[model samples]
Target: MMVKPLATNRSSSGMSTGKLAVWWLIASEIVIFGGVLASYLMFRLGHPEWGAAASHTNTWAGALNTMVLLTSSLSAVLAHQAAEQGDGKKAARFLYFTVLGALMFLVIKSFEWTHEIGLGFTLQSGGFWSFYYLAAGIHAAHVIAGAIIMIWVAAYAKRNEELQRVEYIGIYWHFVDIVWIFLFPLLYIAK
Candidate 1:
């Protein structure tokens, strides 16, 4: 008996199936974040006092994390480039750098949060604190998830298997960074 080979489905939109799926995931994330941000903006406008609470946020820490994430994004882009060139080891190295950046960002965030909580800026402190925790917490979770995924991709990249995944992971990392870009300004610089 002969078996038929499975066929790959091409995207009608001219995108790779993997890339298209990533875009769809990002679109959904945008809606979730947009709703939260819109609600925060509405409440912030109605309760101007929220600005006073926001002022207490560590601007320096936020700025540092911004730089870290941006650097990580550059590494992710480089990983994709290396993967395209079929340099699996080089691609894996870049991915490791990206993961390191994520760790640095998380560390800075934890310190900032600890200081704020010590100063009585707990979630139950007020509406502003609640929103602050919710938004940043979700973003951190994404960062953690991205780092783990990158690590997995890096392992495969080193073996030259599934190299296309490097690009997909890069796309996801960029989205994560962009989210932080919006969040840093809103949470730390808006005051």
Candidate 2:
């Protein structure tokens, strides 16, 4: 007979394994974003001229994207709640709304980037543009990743009845939003 090992929920330190794992992941992410933002601040401080360069970015677009992300966070929370209630269908619906928000965010971002580049604001324009592209581009990538995760979570909820993970994914999705909350002010409104 083949023996199946039991998967325990408690870690060696007596912490809930899932929560500990999520916290570890979040801690690593903080290191990554923190390093990037610190470097950006250092550069911005050293080069006082970057202020005028920062002003060229569209504030309205940044504000709109912030709203989109905030709304997505709300949808993610709703999805998690539905999952907790064992309503897979409702969970899927809320997840779909979250995905739609990501799509909207990307569309707006695309237009904003194209318009800015058309106005001669390429990455080569200056150090500020470089950082702008780097920061926004990374945030957009995270948005894409979150959307993909949402789709998978929704599908799993539909067939596997595994809605408990909704909360985990929601936490990650909210982290992405929180990053944007800081990025918006640093890149768009700081100047």
Candidate 3:
């Protein structure tokens, strides 16, 4: 017989245990990402010369990635809704779509980095380049992590098991997309 974990515990806050956990994690992540972006903004504001470096960044590529991530977030929402409706197969399909969007964002980002690096905009190039790579790289790492977890979650969702986890992963995926939304303008459009 399959054993069910304590997956049904609703907190006093009217949230599931799993959802509360995801929110707690997201709160912690906000601190981390907030620190990085705040620091970048401070530096960018103080150093006007950084605009030149920022201008070198490919805005079109950043915008494209932004669109991709937003679309992925929509798929994640659909996955959560499917899970809620007891449609595990549909949830898994939407989760796969979300993962595809994550991969596409990464691919576009990689090409953008390749082009920048080809033009000698290395991380060691200057302060602006350093912050650019650092912030974007951290966000990219999160994308990779979200994609991997999503694949695992999708597997169980396909089997109609742990349907609640679909919602949990969707929360995490949305957080990742939100981070990109902040990063895109700070690192790309601020020029």
Candidate 4:
């Protein structure tokens, strides 16, 4: 009997493998972040006094980071557009801008955290501080991860190789931005 070949690489859902994989990854991330945020909300409602701690957060810093992430998202979109136009160098330059935004975000976050910690708002301070750190720390990790991936994608973008990956990275970067959108108000402005 002749051995049958594996099915076509395309999923039965009609989505390309890369796109489907990114969606799946995003879905999983949503569930994780959603659960965490929901838990934080429940705790927040129970402990209204936490607002005092939340108020200690630097609104300016959080707002600045929000703008940075939103701007970086625009860069990611432009990079994807450039890739579609077959302009690898342009795409790489835009990706570099996105990465720079990510760096700026982390730098600002580091300063904020340092200031907070120096003021005695640390992980062991209280529930509000703990949640604040937990949420922001996780988000920062995502930012770093996205920046690293963008660097890799930009390298290939410069070479005009794996152009499709540029779009995939864009999707992930946008999702990261959306997560921060949810987080900023919850952690910084809710008070």
Candidate 5:
């Protein structure tokens, strides 16, 4: 009887385990965000007062953050491309730039929050304010988490000659950007 070699390294299919895992994580994230978005829509329709309160949110700030996230996404893609080409150093550089963009987004958000809260528009101000802060805050947390992940990927790239993790990290980062795209128009652009 001949013994077969145990299946190892990537699945029998050849699909990277890292990429597959990221997709699963993204699918779960979609459900969580979908639920949040659905609840927001229902709340928006149920209460007319929210519209008036929503008017108080700074659209320009939100727009700036949108730009920041978009730029970071571009950097993340470039980073992943570099990694796939086995240029870990270049990938690390791009990842660091992406992190900078994320930090810029957070700083802008902090300023927006401070300005709004100082204007006596606290989360307790009204239904819209509550939802606005809640949604935006949750998204901001995701941004921070993505940035931290990027930092870890960057560190790995610096010390290693080749890293398959960069591409998966890029995928997750892009998903974060896509979520913000939907959120930007809904929370900031849409009156």
Candidate 6:
């Protein structure tokens, strides 16, 4: 006898269980990220002198990462399209490209952080620097987590199993990219 999870077999909602679960997770993540960003905004507005610390952020590196994330999002879109057409291999291939973009973004972020740290921009440097590291560090953690999950999803997709997961991870990846769109301007351009 074979048994599957009850959620897999039952769907009272119009959405698939996988989709609903992903959305639920995303909603929780939104609450967390929203709180952090909102707090940072309040702090930034209260202390104009923090602009000095903001000036230290690497706009070029941020811009480059923005492009990488956006491009990776495009690959995610393509992966979803392939999965919809029942081409799991193609979907997995696109997912791999998307992961490559994630790795590239992380590498650039590391170099930028190394340079800033070398120049004495530690988390304790100032109020703005503190929020900068907190917000950006959280975002970077999400990027790393997303990439790891994406790799696992891609492995299943390559085997033509759990193809619908392609869309779920794409949703999460887009959210990650959108966060960067917000962070890039706030962290890199507000100076």
CA lDDT scores, all candidates in order: 0.93, 0.88, 0.94, 0.92, 0.85, 0.93
lDDT of 6 by residue, 32-102 (tens): 98998899999999999988888888899999999999999999999999999999999999999999999
- Tens digits of lDDT, candidate 3, 95-125: 9999999999999999999999999999999
Which 10 residues in a row give candidate 1 its minimum summed lDDT?
2-11
Candidate 4 local Cα displacement, residue 57, angstroms: 0.3
TM-score of 5: 0.92
- By TM-score, the better pick of 1 and 6 is 6
TM agreement with the true structure for every prediction:
0.94, 0.91, 0.95, 0.94, 0.92, 0.97
lDDT of 1 by residue, 38-113 (tens): 8888888899889999999989999999999999999999999999999999999999999999999999999999
Candidate 1 off by > 4 Å:
1-9
Q: TM-score of predicted model 4? A: 0.94
Better of 4 and 6 by TM-score: 6
Off by over 4 Å in 5: 1-8
lDDT per residue for candidate 2 within 1-191, as digits (tens), equals 95434343445766555656767887888898888889999999899999999989889999999999999999999998888888888999999999999999999999999999999999899999999998888889989988998899899887646676787788889999999999999999978
Give the higher-TM-score candidate: 5 or 6. 6
* Residue 30, candidate 5: alpha-carbon lDDT: 95
lDDT of 6: 0.93
Q: How many residue pairs clash in each candidate?
A: 0, 0, 0, 0, 0, 0
Off by over 4 Å in 2: 1-5, 8-16
Error of 2 at 133 (Å): 0.6
Per-residue lDDT of 1-191 in model 5, one digit per residue for the tens? 96534442357556766677889999999998888888888988888767777787788888888888889999999998888888899999999999999999999999999999999998898777877888888888988998898899899898764378888889988988898888887788667
RMSD of 2: 2.3
> Which should have the higher TM-score, number 2 or number 4?
4
